[model samples]
Target: MTRFALTVEYDGRPFMGWQRQRHGPSVQQAIEEAAFAVTGEVATVHAAGRTDAGVHGLAMRAHLDVAKPFAAFRLMEALNARLRPAPVAILACNEVADDWHARFSCVGRSYEYRIINRRAPLTFERGLAWHVARPLDAEAMHVAAQRLVGLHDFTTFRSAHCQSASPVKTLDRLAVVRDGERVLVRTAARSFLHHQVRSMVGCLAQVGLGRWSADDVTAALEARDRQRLALNAPPDGLFFVAASY
Candidate 1:
């Protein structure tokens, strides 16, 4: 069997997230179906991250193994051709060793959350970003985000349904910046607790809106309790931006 690694980009508004579901469409199902169309053999596509519904992917890393022999480029083109109208694209593809894995081999991952801090309704980017009518202090948010950087017990930011065995994770960076009316929050880590980024963003938004202070963020992290969470931001603005092996 030959293993092929694929870099994928997709608009996640129409699917039930990255994983295949019995009830709805999924990015994995789409790519797997396309793979069968190309190789005439069943395959399973594994990703570096499993994003929630409505969470887009700018450059998600995934891999699959096939028994049939085919050039990497030919397989990529065939998959793209057959995956038409799915809003999912195979951006790059290459052969990898059989032992390589898309998820377990990944060493780093990054995500970005976009918020349009404006009152006007979205026209072209309706479901692509989080629309906040209130003005956000990106500087304040950045200051508050620093509290979340480095290693910590992030139980306060984890999801109730998270399957990870441990809540202790090291965050490399979390920065908030403003590009015109858009507020961008970018984060990097070796791994993150489920909903950790969204939960951090929601509390930072409170600080930006003057409802919470930077000290409150530190306090929350120290409390290490899920009930102390400020809010859980919607998945609309989150994007799996990059993954490194």
Candidate 2:
């Protein structure tokens, strides 16, 4: 069998998440179904990271092993044809070394969260962004968020149900910026505990709104308590932007 790596793009609004679920459609199932359409055999596909419901992905990487190899261009064409109506497409495909696992081989992943800070509700971006009716201090949020870049015990930023072996993860980049009305938070790391990025964004928003000082992030990190942090920002604004090997 030969291992094939596929770059996928999807609109996550219409499905459950990346992982297969009993009750709803999933990104994984779509790929499996498409692989069947392409090769006449069902293949198990593993993703670099599993996203939550309502989150979108601009570029997600996954891998599947096939009994026969198809040219990369031909596989992409066939998979996209079968995966339509679910808003998923195979952006690219390439053969990789048999030992290269999509999830475990990834060196880093990046995510972006978008929030609209204004007094009125957005008509065009109903579920595409987080709508807040107050001004956000992007610069303040940027400064406060920077404190999280580096190795730290990030229990405060992890979900209660996070099953990662450890809560210690290094954040390589965290940037908060404003483009017009939306406050954008971009984060990247080698790996993350569940909800880590959203958790950090929630805490940063508190500082952005003057509810917490920048030092509050440090306190929470040192406390190592999940309850010490703020909200876990909504999933709508989050997107799996990219993955690098």
Candidate 3:
């Protein structure tokens, strides 16, 4: 058997999430079925992280083991051919060591949240970005985001459904910046709790709107209570940008 590493990209709008689901379609299901069609083997695909419904992935890292004999390039071509019509695509593929793992070997992950700060209705960016009609002070948002950039108890930003054992995590970086009418929130960490990035972006949005002060964010973090969370941004704007080994 050979293990293959895959770099996948997908539009999250059409599927439930990265993982397979009984109720709806998923990115994993699509790719797995395509692989089965190509290799006639029941292979399990493991990803670096799982994204929620409506959350997209630009370059998700995944690995799967197959018993079929095929060159790395040929397998990638066959998988892509069979994955036709699905938004999921295998951007790159290569063989990896048997001990290499997509999830366990990952050391860092990053996500990007896009916000369209405009009153006009979205045309091309619909379902791809969050539209905030009210003007936002990106600079204020940036300053407030810095408060979440270190080790802290992040229970306030964690989802009630989060299965993580601990709410305490080290946030390596969190930055808010503006380019024209676009407000972007970029964050990185070893791993994140459920809804952690979206939750942080929501609170920072409040700061941009002048609804909350930086002290409010500090207080929320110190509270270590989920109820203290200001808001949870929708999944439309969230994108799994990359995973590092």
Candidate 4:
């Protein structure tokens, strides 16, 4: 079998998430179906990250093993052709070593959350971003975000259903930026607990709204209790921005 790496993009509005589910469509199942159409074989593909329902991915990476010889670029075109209208696309396909696993080889992962602070329901951004009616304090949010940029046990930000063995993670970066009425939060880590990014965003939003102080965020992190964390942000605003190998 020839091992290959695939760069994928998808609008997470239509499916049940990145992984396959018995009850609904998924990015994995979509890609797998396309792979079967092209290679006449069902091969399990692995992704760099498994996004939750209603979450999008801009540069998700995957690995595929095919027994038949096929050109990388050609495979990309064929797969996209078959996956049309499903809100999923195979961005690129390139040869890789058999030992190179997409999820395991990843060195870092980046996520971005977008929110429209002064939105009138965000008609254009429906299902794409979070819409908030009140303006946010961007300066305070940025300054407060610095407190989370280090190694810490993030149990408070983790979901109870997280499959990761531990909640300890090193937050390499957390940046808050503003673009007119839209606010974006970008974060990176070596690995993350499930729902960690959204959970952090929820807490930061409190700070932005002047409800939660920076000390409150710190206390929540130190508490290591899920109940102490802020309400989990909606998944519509979250996007898997990139994966660094």
Error of 1 at 219 (Å): 1.3
Give the per-residue lDDT of model 1 (tens digit) for 115-169. Answer: 9999898888888998889999999999999999999999999999999999999
| Cα-lDDT of candidate 2 | 0.91
TM-score of each: 0.99, 0.97, 0.99, 0.98
List candidate 4 segments past 4 Å from native. none
Candidate 2 lDDT over 84-108, as tens digits, reads 8789988889999999999999999
- Model 2 spans with C-alpha error above 4 angstroms: none
Clashes of 1: 0
Q: Candidate 2: TM-score?
A: 0.97
For model 4, the run of ten residues with the poorest summed lDDT? 116-125
Candidate 1 — which residues are off by over 4 angstroms?
A: none
Residue-wise C-alpha lDDT for candidate 4, range 1-245, written one tens digit per residue = 89989999999999889999999999999999999999998899899999999999999999999999999999899999999879898887999999999999999999999988994778888999988787789878888888888999999999999999878889999999999999999999988889999999999999999999999989999999999988999999999989988
Better model by TM-score, 2 or 4?
Answer: 4
Q: Estimate, for each residue in 122-157, the C-alpha lDDT of model 3 and write its tens digit.
A: 999888999999999999999989999999989999
Sorted on lDDT, best first, the list reads 1, 3, 4, 2
